[model samples]
Target chain A: MSMLEKLQPIFREIFDDESIIITKQTTANDIEDWDSLTHINLIVAIEKHFNIKFALGELQSLQNVGEMLALIEEKVKKNE
Target chain B: MNEYKLKDMIVGLTQSFSVDITNEMMDLFLRLSGDNNPLHIQREFAKGMGFSDRVVYGMLTSSFYSTLAGVYLPGKYCLLTGIDVSFHKPVYVGDRLTITGEIEFISESTGQVEMKARILNQKNEKVSKSKIKFSLLE
Candidate 1:
């Protein structure tokens, strides 16, 4: 499955919203519940699901879901 | 009670404490929470429900988790961020509960520590388990 397809469920579970449809341009501003606390929870959940650990500052610059997907893809590739 | 700085905490570090559940504790909990459920407040009701006596409030039993965080594991620097807990068995008044916690994960970048903890009664049966997370304020 594609990265977004895999990430969709994680988003749904974290936000407790099954209707979330994420796109390349989907930013935190687009989600009402995407605050600092949930951001941390999202990062932790994403890291666990992808089996990748993000170093400090690696996620600080991400502006949208597409960037996050790109980062995960790169890390997963590196792991392989 | 012991105070631990952020630098002092390591993965696998563990702390254990014992708490004696008493009538005063139950009275205090009732005063504070006003949770007067018959199972918790009435011995006859609890006995009819098959428990040996009045059941202790689950929250009261779990409240010691705060002591575990604030006084033991990471100690005075702890700022609890979250807790995920499960009640596996019932706890009753007059039980001696031993609470133990161990650091499972430490994030130096965020100054956060996650601990796996459990409470066991005098009978050595686990009554509750928790995953507690806190930020260490340096």
Candidate 2:
């Protein structure tokens, strides 16, 4: 499966909404439950799902789903 | 109390201790929490329900998770974030429970740590399991 497909369920589960459909332009502002705490939970869940770690200040630069997807792709490719 | 700082904790660190459930604990829990459930207070009622004896309140037994996080794991700077718990076996009054917690994940950017914990009876049967999350203030 593509990385985005793998990530979709994580978002859906975290937001407790099965209807969530994320795209490159999707930002935290698009999701009702994507507050600071859920943002942390999202990061933690994503890290676990992908078996990757984010550095301090690295995630501070992320603004939307596209950036997060790109970061994960880069990290996963580097690990491989 | 443990004075562990965020930098001092690493994944896989573990802490364990034992506590006894007593009549005074049951009374204090009933008086303070007002949980007068017959299943937790009346042995006869519990036996009627097929439980061996009056079951200790699940919350009372799980309350040790607070002590595991606040007093042991990352003691001084710990700020609890969340907990997910499941009770597997009925815990009775007078049971000695051993609580064990092991660090599972740590997010430095979020200042968060997640640990997996379990409460085991003296017979080595698991009575409860939980995942606890906390943030470090420092």
Candidate 3:
């Protein structure tokens, strides 16, 4: 599966909606429940799904799903 | 209050202040924020959920970062632009928390200073941490 495909399920699960289709442009403004509290939950879920850790600084810099997927791909490749 | 210029802030400049989390403070926050979550206001409900007592609203604990930046770090003539916080533990009534802010970075171009903010309970456990961004005002 592609990175977007892998990430799509996680976003759906975090948002508790099956219809969330994410692209590089997808951001907090596009989601209904993407407040600060849920943002942490989404980050934690993404970290666990990817089996990686995100530094607080890195977390602050990610502004969209594409950036997040790029970071995840980079981290996963580094770990392999 | 001391007016801090962007050049005056050096990495490792620090300030510390303490606040006692009293029931009255919680009540005041509850009213101001209109956060009527039972987890913070109802003892039996909180106890049922495994907390020893009502959990003081997490934002109330996090609010100290504002106090740290606006009152002490830059002290005077400061405008808080942003804050990113992580809550590690729940705060309960009567827990005395020491809030500390340390300068981590200063940008001369933007007149913005980034500070690492932390809140530790009397037991010396960190309950919350935040990175706060502020700019010195003229």
Candidates, DockQ: 0.36, 0.61, 0.04
Residue-wise C-alpha lDDT for candidate 1, range B1-138, written one tens digit per residue: 688987888889999999999999999999999899999999999999899999999999899999999999888888898899999999987899999999987655445678999999999999999999888777
Better of 2 and 3 by DockQ: 2
Q: Report how far off residue B34 is in candidate 3 (Å).
A: 1.1
Worst 10 residues of 3 chain B by lDDT: B105-114
Per-residue accuracy of model 1 over A29-64 as CA lDDT, tens digit each: 999999987777787777768778788788888889
User: Best candidate, TM-score-wise?
Assistant: 2
For all candidates listed, what's the TM-score of chain B alone? Answer: 0.96, 0.98, 0.96
Better of 1 and 3 by DockQ: 1
Q: Of models 1 and 2, which has the larger lDDT?
A: 2
- Which portions of model 3 miss their true places by more than 4 Å? A1-80
How well does each candidate superpose onto the true structure, as a TM-score? 0.92, 0.96, 0.64
- Candidate 3 TM-score, C-alpha based: 0.64
Tens digits of lDDT, candidate 2, B26-114: 99999989999999899999999999999999999989999999999988889988899999999988899999999999887777789
Q: Over 4 Å off in model 1, which ranges?
A: B5-9, B108-111
List the candidates ranked by TM-score, beginning with the highest.
2, 1, 3
lDDT of prediction 2? 0.92
| Candidate 3 C-alpha lDDT tens digits along A1-80 | 99999988888987889988899999999999998656765766666677776664676777888898899899899889
Q: In the order shown, what is each candidate's alpha-carbon RMSD?
A: 1.7, 1.1, 8.7
